[model samples]
Target: MSVEQVSIEDLGRELGERIAETPEYERFEEARAAVQRDEEVQSRIDEFEQLRAEFMQARQSGQATNEGLQRVQEAQDELHAMPVMSEYLDAQDELEDTLEAVNEAISEPLAVDFGGEAGGCCQD
Candidate 1:
């Protein structure tokens, strides 16, 4: 079929399906599942999220302290130090890299940056 015969939405959906089948995507999915199934990682995530939320609330109320910000940073560091969390993060980064390369490829033939500028407006 000619390019004009396929709807943009259909092409987008097909692209998404193809991306989902990539090895990077598969690794990311597996790593995500492992993270979800690990109680220790989950607990650390919960702790980090709670600390971050409390920090945000304090900041919103104009009562945020350096100590609170430090606590949140420490919690984030501790969470990221976990083996499972590290693996998940690495897999996620690889998947993001793959997507970025695909985005560049798609953007190259277009007038705009397909991934970054397609929906944005008010540019000079």
Candidate 2:
């Protein structure tokens, strides 16, 4: 190939390095690290997951109850209320928005959605 015909792999690596240097990326990294280091946040997340699993099992066994549902909801609420989890979630949203904007810019010249995984129709 000619010198003018650069590989997409090289371009992708260059782009990734530049993106990592941005303040947005730094904030995301710091928030992610903080969340990981917070034992309280991790514990709450584990508890919430456990409660959710129990709820699912109960539902599958036709043994679901309002109390079980309430327990799961309460655990979820407690987890979301944690400062570390909230900050991490906000940072994650910011990062996703940044990525989507980048994708739009990348796809604009081609007039195509240069693309990410398309989600299923069913809502969680």
Candidate 3:
């Protein structure tokens, strides 16, 4: 075979071998999996946001009394312990941090009070 033809064949084989050995392909697969996890987490976050809005509205409208606040708190607790991928743990941590900030903002007195009602508050 001519030297040029032999060199071209060797180059193609080396390229294939290098591709097989590269870590980037595995990393890419991992990243794709992580992205899927993030997408699921995002959907959960949207649901939580909607639920939170409803809870807030109920409290604001005096529909949710102390019993209602307890229900909301229970829901928040469930959300705080939501499932997330290990690869996307950072994203979950960020979400937790954001929720803490929101809690702090709503921690002030007279902010959506749920007092003066001792009755049953059920949400279905």
Name the top lDDT candidate.
Answer: 1
lDDT of 2 by residue, 1-124 (tens): 5668769999999988988987778888999899889999988889999999999999999999999999999998888888888888888888888888988898888766666533455633
Off by over 4 Å in 1: 1-5
- Residues 22-76 of candidate 3 have per-residue lDDT tens digits of 4544444454475566765667567667777887898788786776567657765
**Model 3 clashing residue pairs (backbone):** none
lDDT of 1: 0.94
Tell me which of candidates 1 and 3 scores higher on TM-score: 1
Clashes found in each candidate (C-alpha, N, C closer than 3 A): 0, 0, 0
Where is the poorest 10-residue window by lDDT in model 2? 115-124
Residue 107 deviation, candidate 2, in Å? Answer: 2.0
After superposition on all C-alphas, the RMSD of every candidate to the true structure, in Å, is: 2.3, 4.2, 21.0
Ranked by TM-score, the better of candidates 1 and 2 is 1
Q: Per lDDT, what order, best first?
A: 1, 2, 3
lDDT of 1 by residue, 1-124 (tens): 5665888899999999999999999999999999999999999999999999999999999999999999999999999989999999999999999999999998888866877868867887
